[model samples]
Target: MTQGFSPTSTRRGTLAGIAAGAATLAMPRIARAQSEIIRIGFPTPLTGPFAAEAKDQVKSAELAVKQINDKGGVAGRKVELLVRDDKLNAGEAATRTLELIEKDKVHAIVGALSSAVQLAVNEVTRARGVIYVSISQSDTINEVKDFSRFTFHEALNPHMTTAAVAKHTFKKGSKIAYLVADYAYGHEMLRGFKRAQEALGATSVGEILHPFGAADYSTFMPRLRSMRPDILCICNFGRDQANAIKQAVDFGMNRQARIVVPVLLHNQRLAIGPEAFDGVVGGANYYWGLEDTIPSAKAFNDAFKAAHDGAYPTDYGAYGYTGVYSLLLAMQKAGGTETDKVIAALEELKYDVAKGPQHYRKCDHQSVQSVLVLESKKKGEMKNPADLFKVLATEPASEDILRTCKELGFPA
Candidate 1:
């Protein structure tokens, strides 16, 4: 949502090429062995409704590569970040991922914007035994059926995020309704919301499933109003979230029930503005405002700003950086890019990057990290244009917030 960098086609294609080529070509056999090109595949929706978020993701990932290359890269090997536009379609995502791995020979993968798209891309990565650091949210990805030894989830799953949100926002006997996108992401969020509802003794009024990128919420608005829920949870992302919130406000629903988003995006808040987004509560993986109190946040924020004309990174955009940077660190720790060695290294990795200290859970490869409970700021509360969220609480990274390994169908 903030002013961020977008790569031109020419620049995108040539990224890290010269450095990697020179580093490898100039070396003798012994020297060149450690200087081989390490290509990282990045697949995200760059042409659809999620374009804005994808652009941010690309910029942040590029920043990670730039920072790493500046330090001479992993064990003298330069990284060539090969990005592809998945167009937000599962089939297209799979196709692009295959090309990256088979054609481009990328050693690993780091980006996916949507739940379904991530799942599709995961299939390709998993089949090839390539390490995938998913930046998208999905509970199913952590489950045994979809998870593999090489799979690492850098983003918070639906259960972990929603449970924290419910603890903070839900009251005993509260009536809730859901406006879910009709897909894997929405279904997963709905499942988590229901679990939260049961845990908190909150009652569900009704649920309405809408298309992922639906432009109109008119039909669903009237039915939602009839439900008369005390809290309305809109489980969607990107422009869908912005449009739904705007339409809800126009329908005077905001006056009746509190609105909660499962994932609050900085760009979405900017699109909806403070007026429509005001008083909304949601969970965030990272917020640039944390730079004030967190040293790592300050580092990431300063570097991003220095590169992109003083623009702060978006919450989702932080995932892109964390995913790539963490993977590269793991490769460095492993001393090479062998799949098994890298996997072992990632499991043992403890990183403090865009956020606080975090590591992947061995059982499911889910990143153990904090979830910030953020409330949208009112227009009167704005200190600056970018000051949109007021952090209410920081839910510390704990196994308690996450689904247990046993719950994810993992054996003891």
Candidate 2:
């Protein structure tokens, strides 16, 4: 249960600035920002499919901001977070992003849970020249077609997730079937899976793209048996993922094919319960226990747990903390909140904010960090609620699994 990042192999150091490319609801834009305070916008789902994860995101973000303020604020200006709920609606997300800028005049943004919300907010943040660090993992956001200078991708995307577990997923057999969420993220996930399957000499049996908020997956279970898949990969997250796995178990599909999730969230695991995911194996970007391996991670977690009822951190929580923490660093380095100066500082910034050394590729505004493969142990084997999985492999960001900015078609 004490999963370390194998510091020797994964590499370690303080993470630094990532001028990455880059959330919310209807919270009224604060009419004024006091000269003594710096406001940062946090737009994310508070009442939607990703709500559980978003709560963790907000908690970590708030903690980071408070720490900054406690340490005499950034450049003598207190840090304040203005939050809004986007309801996981892209239109609402974009609107909130604009409000955070045009009205609240937030220096930057941190915390977006869904790819759709992240993408939509990115469009607005970029156009406004505001920095946005995303917590969602959709490779398309970094695609040259949609890449933005003002945005930094902080979360591991589908491509990165694939690098962590595709080989193991295909190890059992060649006939692969997938039930993906029908959206931009699902499309990117499918692309990553297809690429990996082809490279591993695996054949696709069949695939299904269900709606985002789908609750019933019983429809697919009856038909899935004919595919005779060696692996049934579920490319979804939050409630959609939990529901699909639950029904798949009900249909007795768990005994038929190995269930593989591209990237599993802490909240999703809790929602799916131990019974549904007792033997599930997948990848993750971060875990609270990893703080034990990385000093910076421990710094964040110690304070977070002490104040938040001893609850551990999730990857989303890590993203929220790092996103806000790094921005504060950039602002301090820049000595002001001007867009150009902050961006320059972020391009070279590093801090021990989380596990391993994280940095942003100046070319694409994508954070380079490690991706971890994990397998959930049986419930009886778990020593604590947080010890959901055993770390199987830790792939350093230096590996070729995550494409270089140039390879991703980012202009030099």
The candidate that wins on lDDT is 1
Model 2: per-residue Cα lDDT over 68-163, one tens digit each: 888988888889999899999877887787778767878898777888778777766765567888888888777776676778887888887885
Q: Write down the lDDT that model 2 would get.
A: 0.78
The lDDT per prediction is 0.87, 0.78
Task: Give candidate 2 misplaced runs (Cα > 4 Å).
Answer: 1-35
Error of 2 at 332 (Å): 1.4
State the lDDT of candidate 1 residue by residue for 1-412, as single tens digits.
1011122234322322322333344433232355678889999998988888999999999999999999989988889899899999977887788678666777899999999889777766665557899999999888876766778999999998999888899999999989999998999999998999898999999999998899999889999999999999999989999999999999989999999988988998997799999899999999999988889999999999999999999988899999999999999999889888999999999999988889999999999999998999999999989999999888998888898899899997
lDDT for position 171 in model 2: 61
User: How does residue 254 of candidate 1 score in lDDT?
Assistant: 91
lDDT of 1: 0.87
Give me candidate 2's TM-score against the actual structure: 0.89
